[model samples]
Target: MQVTSHFYAQLTIAIIKGVASCLRLFHVLGLIILCSSLSLPLHAIEQSSNTQIKQVHLHDNQGKSINIGQLHVQADGQFTFELRDEVFSDHFLSMKEMKYIEGPELWCHIAYPYPLNRDFNADKAWLSHDLLFMYKKSNQFGAMMWQGVYYKFTKEDGRLIGYANGVDLSEIASAPEQIHTPFYDESYMEPHNAQERWLPTLTID
Candidate 1:
């Protein structure tokens, strides 16, 4: 009888340990699931593609070729462009506000409210930079890149070809209220000025 009781006690202890181990495993799995849920929003941002870098070149009014930077063009006609810091130091860009952007590489986008659309109004487009939020903090009306820019798209046997024309840098200096306005605000949307001749032509590869 004593041996029987001892065996039963040992079996009960083993069962208790198994249940405790299962509880610990469940707790760890729950924590992992919670962490994965928390990280989803950050990864949910719109990405042009899984990962693709396309080179871009700029042709000035004088017909000088300039290496702009890497670009990722989405099927929806949006563009993610990264520019080199040396491009800002060049004589082509005369804006003093360029100094305010706090980064060695400048990333700009033609997205959302101003995505490049061929079926829609394809002529007027805007290129806003990643640093626009920083300027917004100071309650200053500024854009890191061009606002009222001209873009034209062509279809070669159903393949879409994009072209960017004259961009006015002065649009960076706008009314202070423009700072408060949401990027989706269409009130400031307008055609590019004819006289503005910074990048006369842009070729996207």
Candidate 2:
């Protein structure tokens, strides 16, 4: 009986030691997993902080200059220009072709493929050719649509040009409101002298 009792006590100690070993192992694994999870967010934040934003200086046709704060290129090849004063944020621009124009002026031309109206169904909608122009020397910006309406912007003010039927870009308080062409007005057109000079052509080597 004594021997049997001693054997049982030894068995209990062994079982308890085994359970304690397993618990310690599990605790170590849990600590490792927690540490790994914490490091992932830190790494992501570091990467985000390292993202670079490019600066651009541009002038309009009227000799007005704007210092663009940041320029971002999206994955779809669209470019976003952010103005210094936050007058515009994430303004989308697309440049698919670099046409050689002989002039002493610097002009930035953009073609937009996406519809300005998000709710309009593109499949059944009548698409218009949305073209935007920015002059380097004159400090003028304009957009010409296929529907015969346009918007012109200068350093001091902006106006809706062309037919009186479209949306007024000047009245657009938000970026979302500037998307639809039908909302612009054509009666707001003002006469301005067009600059014949252009900046030097961009060369990609």
Where is the poorest 10-residue window by lDDT in model 1? Answer: 129-138
TM-score of 2: 0.34
Whole-model Cα lDDT per candidate? 0.45, 0.39
lDDT string for model 1 (1-205, tens) is 9999999999999999999999999999999999999888657654424545556555554566666577665565555667656654322123433322222223232223322233121332233322121111223344434443444435455333334433443444453344333333334335333335344345555
Alpha carbon lDDT at 12, candidate 2: 100
Q: Tell me the TM-score of each prediction against the true structure.
A: 0.38, 0.34
24 in model 1: Cα distance from truth in Å? 7.5
After TM-score superposition, what is the CA distance of residue 191 in candidate 1 from its true location, in Å?
Answer: 18
lDDT of model 1 at position 54 = 58
Tens-place lDDT per residue, model 2, 33-128, is: 999999999998886664434444434455554443454433343434443454332332233232212135333333333444322123111111
How many Å off is the CA of 14 in candidate 1? 3.0
Error of 1 at 164 (Å): 11
- Cα distance off (Å), candidate 1, residue 137: 34
What value of lDDT does candidate 2 attain over all alpha carbons? 0.39
